[model samples]
Target: MTDATDMAAVRVDAPGTSATARLLAEAARAVDAPDLVLAVSRGGVRTVHTGGSAAPGPVPRELLTYELGSASKPYAGLLLARLVAQGRVRYEDRAADLLAPGLPVHPAVRRITLRHLLTHTSGLPGLPADFYPQAVPRWSTGPYGGYPADRVVRAFLRARPRRRPGTRWRYSNFAVSVLGHTLAAATGTPWEVLLHQQVLAPLGLDATRVRPGPDGTDAVGRRRDGTPVPALDTGGFTAAGAVRATPLDLLTFLEAHVGGPEPRDPALNAALTEVTRPLLRRGLRHAHTHTLTWFQHPSPYGRVLFHAGATLGQQAFLGFRPDSGLAVAATATRRVHRGDTFVATAYGLLTETP
Candidate 1:
């Protein structure tokens, strides 16, 4: 609603050297998005601003919040990790163990574990097959709006798994959403509330939210064609791809990934380390790997841990070099072709940085 330029910059840097300037400039060119918010940090020197926050103007202000899309996945995995650390749940805990009292759960669903869901090895499809036909007509506002938690659980129970659990990797929104429900069932706490109390609140990420609220800084997303894409109503599937947050809040989360202070809870700090460590190898080439939710790319600088996410209209990226304690994040208003150049460029700068 408000022009991005009018919002204050989240962090300011003294005029960085030409090298830093060139890297930022080069990243901006690569993205082809004038309104992209780009952030880079290393050893306490950092710059965070929108390259085109004012597009065609000099002033730059933090833009409104953008849905972090699948970038939110790691948080769900972290919640499970925290639960595990608290001895509340184990990675091998079965869905049936958590959610099978009165609910009808598929036999295969009963075998699925927290690890499988977090690592995308649950063999569940990206979405329930029946979701699309029923959802397309409501695409403008949000396809999943008002889908009840109980019905969503039932859909997973009826849906068939494509492969045996943990046999192979297959990305699934359904799996994580189910994981959220199971976590709630196991802990007697709603998934959203659990995350808020255990993760966001402790990390001081007060601005990150599962659903868009009346935050004055909220930024609406746009389709490739520049038509506004209303924020998604993830409904029961909030853990899958439903977090919307300011760039600053996301950067703080990424900071924890690269050894920033852990939450005040010592158990959570231990779990944070456990969650980021490589857990499973994707049955793919070049030794690519996945942690609980992050994709790990072997880089000379160190394992470049990263994840990029896309909603129908928004794209977000979060990455860091744990070895160097360097982290970077970028976001764009539109879900343009072939993912986003802003993401690519930001990552390029990170990987190429000394």
Candidate 2:
């Protein structure tokens, strides 16, 4: 949906935003990138800032999109929640039940479920061992760009888990990739179509797109050596991580997560609630639990839900306090020594007062 909120308008130093704007500016300068965008919403107020760019243009607009990388998991998780809410699929349903016929797999693969994949307890490794060899050669475009989905399933079938399913928490791009394929097969819809219909369209995220097209307006992913890299093409693995969106669009998504102004779609709201609900506890520094795809941390002010995503040359982060109504989304064009500093700064600003 097109918003009347002008993309080129100047952002004012409104109450609750001055401090964040200051911090965001610092993050933009600290990161080693040609350009970056920072957007945030707190207590119903919104702010946007852009820094550093190679394009002979003004600061990046809030509507200019960036690769979200693993941040796409939340979108995949939300789609699962919507299907479950529709009674079309169940969290406990075995993943193996949804695959195409003739696919081979170990018996343990039959026991994995949507819940297991969503919570990162499916026992699947972070990736197939062969993933790197296949991906590194084309790191400029996308490691897995145009990768075959059937091969992913075949590799998954032959692989054994490090531990029993649900016995421990392990982040697996493979698990989510499988989940996305299974969901698409079950619904008889492409993963991208399902996400756009169920989530983006209803929320009016017109600027957000999967496998971002070759539009010159989108931010370029720059290598450490300053060479330009193509945007990620997840191919059949779009569900695992391949969302491209603008800071404005991302803030709109985060707004929904933190109960900011949003559309009156009840199903989307219910699914979002499910996505944010803590389903399992994951013991880690700062983080305490896992939601559908978000990591939940115990903060002195309240529960903080967070997630970070990175591709070959891009990094993205989202964090928010559901109780305090503070949310942040940041994106950088280049992955470099100072890349991490930008995200850490965003988080610090999100949780602390001015």
Candidate 3:
């Protein structure tokens, strides 16, 4: 059932912040979800819409939970900022110091800071050490199976970074995984609990979950060819890409970043601001940059920040326009491959929201 608040949103116009329902329908057809859920909001009012091959209306949120892949990074980033706001950790704190002394790591790796990891400038490899050789066997389904926490720690301790820390920008799943484990180490709290206490709980995203293994409730993903792709099992990289969420929860996440919705908490609001604040820039053109988590881009509507993620057979997009309080969250139950326009449509929706 549509909530009363969302039902009333039909009469409320936030101005300059929505594409007609037709565009949403078109986007749904292009992505071809079993059920595609979208939530768009501005000026505190929000509307939730669904498009897909499946029969629409109000499918229960439980069956629509989609794996959020790298899109989960923003939550990790938010957790880092929230911890900093709570005085539990600092951005400048070295990851080595947080994880442990004597990681058998090189001097440069030891010098890596939380900010470097958060912004993907830590110079660590994008995946865990020796990922392919082990993952190749399972690549078609779920590739992140063998690297458990112990193995992950062992790999980071033994492997070396190609570039010095903080010298350049390279997206590193390794660095963020280490950061997540490091946070767990530093706070004396488990990764799941800390994330829940810091980010998810405050924003009222009860349907959002951090999963390390399979979930029976979430929608099963499929490839373009219709082969089922198993959900990822991030044994050690729980912080890197283990998030799953219903469209409603994901929409609330975007709304929180826009400072919309109710049941807000003051510290979380501050941390939200900190996460979106541009920390540094990358790319030769300088047009593409990054904040703590999202990619920052210049758009005609204003500056826009977004992050898109793909599991083996699903694509997720989350973005918002802070200046206008326009936010969007979308999910497709198919993998993102070359020429896929799922992300582009979502970006277009953000900039062209009427």
- Listed per model in order, the count of residue pairs whose N, CA or C atoms clash below 3 Å is 1, 2, 0
Which residue runs of candidate 3 sit more than 4 Å off their true CA positions? 1-19, 54-58, 61-63, 102-104, 212-216, 262-264
* Candidate 3, residue 320: how far the Cα is off, in Å: 0.1
Q: Lowest-lDDT window of 10 residues in candidate 2?
A: 1-10
- Model 2, 94: alpha-carbon shift in Å? 0.8
TM-score-wise, the better of 1 and 3 is 3
Show the colliding residue pairs in model 1: 34-52
For model 1 the TM-score comes to 0.89
Tell me each candidate's TM-score. 0.89, 0.90, 0.90
- Model 1 segments more than 4 A misplaced: 1-11, 14-18, 53-63, 102-104, 338-340
Position 263, candidate 3: lDDT: 34
- Per-residue lDDT tens digits for candidate 3, residues 1-354, read 222224343322222245545556555566655556666666656655665665443445323688898999999999999999889999999888777675567887788898888788888889865888988998887678778876776667666788888888988777788889889989999999999888887787777788733445676677877677877787788898889887767767887788765534666778888878887876777657788899988778888889988888888889999888888887877777778878888888888775
lDDT of each: 0.74, 0.76, 0.77
Q: Give candidate 3's error at residue 33 in angstroms.
A: 3.7
- Residue 290 deviation, candidate 3, in Å? 1.1
Task: Estimate, for each residue in 1-354, the C-alpha lDDT of model 1 and write its tens digit.
Answer: 111132242344433545665566557666654357777656534567565532433223244677888888988988888888889999999876678765666778777888888788888898877778868998766787657678678877776786889898888888888899989989899888999988887777767888776845666676666777777778778888888777766777777767665555555687778878887775547377888878888777878888888776777888888889888878877766865566667678678777
